[model samples]
Target: FQISLPSLKERVQDIPVLAKHFVAVFADKTNKAALEITDDYLAALKQYTWPGNIRELKNIIERSVILEEAGKLTTDTLPFEITHTQETGNLSSFDLALVEKQHIKKVLNYTKGNKTETARLLNIGLTTLYRKLEE
Candidate 1:
């Protein structure tokens, strides 16, 4: 019996459910308190292309569960690749400036407006972050 499943990107509606399930599994495996999945986190998962599919999702959730000390799964726990993928919706054209601005803003939000952390997450020096913010 040959069975085939569609890629995660083709099953957007399933993202939230699978993510929540993985969160539960990982939380249990890590022996952590019950973790709540934020709507924004689910939204971010849905937005990602998920090239690595279920295995990738599982790994991400496990990492988030282990790193999250607050008992809540949030976008801040997600990797830069997944989080940054949300900036551009249309793949046909790329707007470097707009995407960069949006990415900076998102990273800033993730860091709770902590410029130093944001700069670190963005891989930019503090001065560079300030310059880009000013632009």
Candidate 2:
């Protein structure tokens, strides 16, 4: 008898449970108890075409847990292919600088105009945040 499990893409409904399980596993292994994940991030994960299947999702969750800070995971923790790719088209020809600027602005807004926290949340340096704001 053989039992077959579906691919990550086919088991999208299971992502949240699987993601939490992976996060807990990685977090305990890494000594980092942070295990927060945003709804948008899970939604993106569900929609993504997982060529690497379960292994891919495991890696993604592990990486996200490893990089997670402030006990929360946002869309920024997602892979570039998942975040930068738009439904309308790819970002190959897109103005990434503008995108960065907009992202900074959004994060800044999210952080309530706190430059230091915004920089931390965006995973950029204080100087870089200042420079981007000036640009």
| Highest TM-score scorer | 1
Q: What is the per-residue lDDT of model 1 for residues 1-135, given as tens digits with 9 covering 90 to 100?
A: 999999999999998889888988888888887899998889889888988999999999998998786879888788766776645454545577766876898779768899999999889999999998888
Task: List per-prediction Cα lDDT, in the order shown.
Answer: 0.84, 0.79
Worst 10 residues of 1 by lDDT: 85-94
lDDT of 2 by residue, 17-132 (tens): 98888888898899986677888888888777777988888998777777667687777677666665565256466676767787897688667799999999988899999999
Q: Which residue pairs show collisions in model 2? A: none
Per-model TM values vs. the true structure: 0.68, 0.64
**Looking at model 2, which ten-residue stretch has the lowest summed lDDT?**
84-93
Residue ranges of candidate 1 with Cα displaced over 4 Å: 89-135
How many clashes does the backbone of model 2 have? Answer: 0
Best by the lDDT measure:
1
